[model samples]
Target: MARASSPKRKPSRRPWRRRLILALKILGVIAALGVIALAVTVYTTRAQLPSFDQLKSSPNGQMIRVHAADGTVIVSLGPSYGEWLSYDEIPKVMRDATVSVEDRRFRSHIGIDPIGVLRSVKLMIANWGTDRRIQGASTITQQVARTIFLSNKYTLSRKAHEAILALALERKFSKDQILELYMNKVYYGGGAYGIDAASRKFFGHSAKQLSLGEAAVIAGLVKAPSHYSPTADAEAAIGRAGVVLQLMAETGAITPEQAADTDPKSVALAPEPHQNSVRYFTDWALPQLDMLIDETNAPLDVWTTLDLSMQRAADTAIKADVPKGVQGALVSIDRDGAVRAMVGGKDYVSSIYNRATTAVRQPGSSWKLFVYLAALEAGYKPDDMVVDEPVTIQGWSPRNDSGHFSGAMKIRTALAYSVNTIAAKLGQDVGFHTVADMARRFGITTPIDTTPAMVLGTSEVHLIDMTRAFASVANKGIAVTPYGITKVTANGVTIYQHEVDRSHVLVAPYVAAEMTDLLQTAVATGTGRAAQIGRPVAGKTGTTTSNKDGWFLGFSSGLTTGVWMGRDDAKRVGGLSGGHAPARAWHDYMIKAVAGRPVEQFDTQVTLPEWQLEPDEESYFGQPDNGMFVDENGYPIAPGTYPGDTPTGPPPQQGYPDAYPGGTYPPDGSRTAPPEQPPVQQPPERLDQDWMDRVLGRTPDPDRRAAPAPARTPPPNDRSRGP
Candidate 1:
């Protein structure tokens, strides 16, 4: 009874409560509407994001370029801008070919044909998840949108986006605009960007120039670029092209007879040459471009100073003459120090070791030019007399090549013959420190020893540096820094250009001229004879100790070339000499390089003095006495000695053996016996000094000069004499 009474009373207690309940019902409805609104906003936000087209045409897009040293164009950057036509401009056979090959439902779709979709769905379901062959139901418009505006992510969300974009694209543009955009944007391999680019790149013609068969082949690439690329597999591409033609006939796009009549020429695709003729020049130029621009996206066309023909000639020559398994490098530069041609190694693909600019090996006698130049700078003449005999300095004795004394010879002869002893003596005389400094001034970056041995090229140097040094001589002693890139243009604007700076290192042109003459002699008659061209040529041959390295550096009127051959490990190769291998390569390359060019000679007019040989001591001493003279005490004595024979006078020097006995001399000056006493040892008078100054120039500092006195011999009765 109490519960029933309380329920009635509670209901009657509140009118405001009823109003609150009504308000709660209205608020619940508003909350539901708000949830729906938020979901719609999130979906719309993602669907409207900018697509690939918008990003591609943006300001920060990547740039491309194709250029050569000479302004020849192989291809270009950006989309091909010709007015693109389809269905109508395209031959009916081509249109049908494309449709039959790419999409059979092209005409029946409103953006996408539902019938194709259902068919694809049924096939997929029947095969379960293992069937990728259930062809995509995307119509041509949808395909264009997927290729250009969306990625290949196969998900419902991506598909929905592609569908929406495709529908929007159809509304915004015509069917022709969509097809044109698709055809002009797809990749066709072989460095081609689009169908037009591909047509030209593969068949060497324009898109409009494609035959029915050729068009079919190009159309087949849309499904898979690599599989149908002519360069990748010619037979597969041809077969696929046949299928397209057959499909065209089946689809009523072409008559069977017409399809049979269209026979395209078999595509003859050539492998693209990996390197340009100016490979080294480009290698040198690319680094400079990196410094000047944001290389990753720089829109620059670089024009180099490389002469392509010369470069090709050089490459061909090296390939023809360089022996197998022997790596070599060749560098040729113009008088202005512009690199004309360079072969970094025997084969760049096999070995990227750019020996031309990278390998640093001993220059051998090639370095002697610096020493001779230093001597010339220090007031030494080319004809200055120096003894080509055994020399000892700091307990190190240097011997000639054959270990035979040549007595005194002119400096020119020493340099031409590359006599190690004479060069060492001259280097010691000229101050090794001066020679080292000269080497640096001549563009040698490798550290050179201040020892006399440096005169014989004991220092290491790169081929490039050696070439530049020889180029300097050809440039009349003006040092030219070698360069490759001439100019770089971007977007019709020159972004960079190279300007060579020529700094004069040698004050006297006559000195360079003299050195050039000596080097010329080396090429003509001495070690570098293999490098002799039909015309005047100046060069030096370098052979390292034990044949560890070989080098031939020479210059024509317009170009200077340096070639080096050696093992990468610095090991000696038996029977290899600079004059034989490297010189031959140099000669072959030069002959081809200068074939049609006019012969130009070095313009050095400085007269070299006549070479003179000093008299051997045997010519001064008479024949040894065999009882020819008697002492006051009736003792037999040598003809040239006094009767006492007490060894009190100056000890007798070892003279050439007398041909005749009893001091009897041959009537002719050619007699084998000792002829006459050479002038007695006396202080050099004015005439002697004049002769010395004329022939040997002023003697270098005594510390730098070879010892003036000849080696002493043991007295006849001395116990120290060797048997």
Candidate 2:
């Protein structure tokens, strides 16, 4: 039987072949379906994606204004919503209106709406070949995908891509999430990128507070923001709002009567564009930030050292105090050498020149500090005496501005008075090269001539450099690199931070302390008295030859400030002197600039032994004074090994002349002997008795007998009068 069955099967074995053919057909059908599904997904995703050029060039994000902690706007960048919220912030009316107009069955559709698609197709066929109007059948998910992931082109390919993306988006997110994204990302005209901006631009309110009618109007603008913008045309927008209201009624979001009663007022355009307050500071700091960041194409948020209060104070002071025909600059730096405020010119817009840090003008007497410092380093004391007599140095004889010589003045008085003759003498004594070297070491990058005139401030320097050097003094001799920025942040991360460069330059603390004391005295009682702030302040004032330049450099507890006033063409202004205009400006600014800050004291205890000067008795008496014991140039030896004889009288006071047991001497070296003492005519006993009576507050009667005269002889004049 098996043999017969096998023969029959062999005769008609087409059954197995038929079975194989059926299996191949099933496989082909499955493969075809898979290809179709993949094709649909690829077409949808590609259509929705925006081109690289559009995304790069288009302004689609939020515009945010960044303000300081005290509300001074420092910068403005695009699209900073600050924080994104969920759909809960969306008003109920807005949500309902959006759903009704954009997608009637958004709650029911998995991703795409068949009814909406059919209606849209009918409208497309009816309006074919007419460029007047077109209908969109995009659900909430589809619109969100188009806005977030697609370009702004209208085509069949874009539609197909949108459909596929909508399906994917629906699967990934809830309907509410899709709607929220659509509302937040969709453009609503008039430079508004989202519903929030739209609401603010049009109604001056938030989307969360929109009325039902306002919600309907805004919902209608989504399809054609420019065409339906109330700011563009009131009639067309009203018509579009009617359509949205009808859709709401049809979708049961509102009743027919509710739709009819919903009326929205026209939107009012914003008045003008907004500008930030710290525009100048932002412009000034951006370049500095670029240098500090140093990363390739990285966005950074710079945290600067600008004190807004101080900046305002400086600006106000400049505007109020700066005279006409004169350009001035002010720079305020912290003790750490961070520039907090700066005004480069009277008006930054009128002139782009930054006078604060860029202008290099002759510092006048301001450079005297360097000269004094040089003298100090050379074992010279502040009390050391230097004659203010005129002298010729390298064929240049400098004269005192006061037009008179002050004979034999202490160095401190010479510096306080800004006496050019004394400064020139000190510079010559210490060597011009030594003073120039000291200036270089103190951060003066300017070219200082080795001529003796340089000691009288012939060198040019900028206000910022002066400020930094003075800040170094305030910082206790620590050399700090001046910086404008402190840190930079981006995307909640600190991308750049300033590393302070602090180095000690002065040889000893006493050197700086002694200089500070002298400077304080200058401010308190000398030429810089105008800079006194009723507080402990140290500063120096400088006026160039013929009052061409005025400068005041000073410091407080937390700040170091420098001010300069001069004509842009280097002409004299108002005959202004450093002790007048520049010092007054410095005082006015500093008084208010550091009103509430705690007072700080300078280092005053460090005693410098080499700077101490003792009087030479041998030299004072005009004796031989031992030329062998003195230096080779016949000057008193410094740190002299031998102690000279001490004077028998009291030390000389400030106002009184030295009591040399001689009467006034002539300008020449000749002196006349004093007249013989009048026979020792002692004071009358009655005179002494009257002084005692006055001290004891007792009145003497006119009849009281006079006291007897002393036994001393009367003068020859008195004897002649009696005879």
- What stretches of model 2 exceed 4 Å from their correct place? 1-72, 77-284, 296-298, 605-723
Instruction: Compose the digit string of candidate 1's lDDT tens values, residues 294-413.
Output: 444446576766666777777776676555556778899888888878888766545546788878887777778787888777777765666666676665455554336766666666
How many clashes in each candidate? 0, 4
List the pairs of residues colliding in candidate 1: none
Top-TM-score structure, candidate number: 1
Q: Which candidate is the best by lDDT?
A: 2
What TM-score fits each model? 0.51, 0.50
Tens-place lDDT digits, model 2, residues 5-48: 44334477789899999999999999999879866775565566
lDDT of each: 0.64, 0.65
